[model samples]
Target: MSSDPGEPARRALERARQSIQKIHQAAIRHRDPSLHEIADEMSEVALILGHDAGPVQDWRPCPVCGAEPGSHCIQRPGHEMVNGMHPERSRL
Candidate 1:
């Protein structure tokens, strides 16, 4: 067993990223018009899965909870973490 608690998640994410890369390469080799579309979609998925995706939207702080940029907003006392980011935060 691995000692690191996040090892599983890290491995899964890496695998997904690699799969996307392979699919993109295959699409390029085929040279079909539809394959080009698939390649574009895979490129978008790669960007979203990249390390730069850690941040929320903008660099500004959350208007509601004042959560700093790159950090998720804090939930209310009875709210779940999934609901933490305030709707107002996206307005920026």
Candidate 2:
């Protein structure tokens, strides 16, 4: 094959494109908020409005973000790790 100096950059751009696509997929897959945390936040809002407290319940850690305090972070399960240009799903 004839050597082309731009081949490496082209390949790099393609790799970057694939990587960005994987991130996009991950974000789309994990865009929902936690229902439990939603309720908690609603309760806080109610209190601000002079209403009764919202429902209080134990915070459950997302499997992807294990052991972290409730911040309602998105959980993509096995997608936390990179496998090639895509994220590998967690089997846990």
Candidate 3:
């Protein structure tokens, strides 16, 4: 038995990656918007669990706040910057 405490989490992370790949494939095959969304959510969750998880990538624009990559998310009707990144933007 592995004495490393992180081993279980590592294994789980690998399994999650495999599951995400399967979900992505099914989403592509069915052309279902809901499936695609689910797959995306699963991928985000997996990334959160993975060891490489880090601060949000700033290369893509946010869908909710319309915050462009490398820019802060501004509150609606105002130019003030939000304290933190939008939840949608934080996801993978």
lDDT by residue for model 1 over 18-75, one digit each (tens)? 6654554454455443643453455456566663222223333566677755467887
- Each prediction's TM-score versus the true structure: 0.41, 0.32, 0.47
Q: For model 3, where is the 10-residue window of minimal lDDT?
A: 51-60
Candidate 1: lDDT over CA atoms? 0.54
Q: lDDT score of model 3?
A: 0.58
Q: Which portions of model 1 show Cα errors greater than 4 Å?
A: 42-92
User: Of the candidates numbered 1 and 2, which has the greater lDDT value?
Assistant: 1
Report the C-alpha displacement of residue 48, candidate 2, in angstroms.
Answer: 44
Among all candidates shown, the one with the greatest TM-score: 3
lDDT of 3 by residue, 1-92 (tens): 99999999888767766665565456556655465467566656756665542344243357777865556665664433345655566556
Clashes of each: 0, 3, 0
| Predicted structure 2: lDDT | 0.42
Report the alpha-carbon TM-score of model 2 versus the true structure.
Answer: 0.32
